[model samples]
Target: MATNNIKLISPDSKLLQYTQIELKDPTDAYLESCFAAIQQNRYTIESNTLVQIGQTNKKS
Candidate 1:
């Protein structure tokens, strides 16, 4: 199953409509619901010392 025919023109070029898309598969999930994980980080290391704090956008 593969089909692709697209033609959309305008701006004095007329003929502005025609589309049929389905190339059997175009990478599913497509980003698994888009994406909205701006920034997230949590770290803590003992003994040797290491710490990071800058967490927001907790997805709520």
Candidate 2:
């Protein structure tokens, strides 16, 4: 199975949300739900590292 990697970016190309979806439970609605939850008060992913699980520059 393949994994789905998604990164939501802000208007400034900042990372607002990051997600990893497995084949078992990956859906557009699920993804959209995850995105909508943080539509407001979002932050850009100023910086991230490979070691980190996700990236969300909520303070950029």
The local distance difference test score of each candidate is: 0.35, 0.45
Please estimate how well model 2 matches the true structure, expressed as its whole-model Cα lDDT. Answer: 0.45
TM-score of each prediction: 0.19, 0.28
* Top of the candidates by lDDT: 2
**Tens digits of per-residue lDDT for model 2 on 1-60?**
222355547677756454644435556555555444545434222243112235556875
Tell me the tens digit of each residue's lDDT in model 1 across 1-60.
211232447667734333434334444222211111111224333363544555677765
Cα RMSD for candidate 1? 16.2
CA displacement after TM-score superposition, residue 60 of candidate 2 (Å): 26
**Backbone collision count in every prediction?**
0, 3
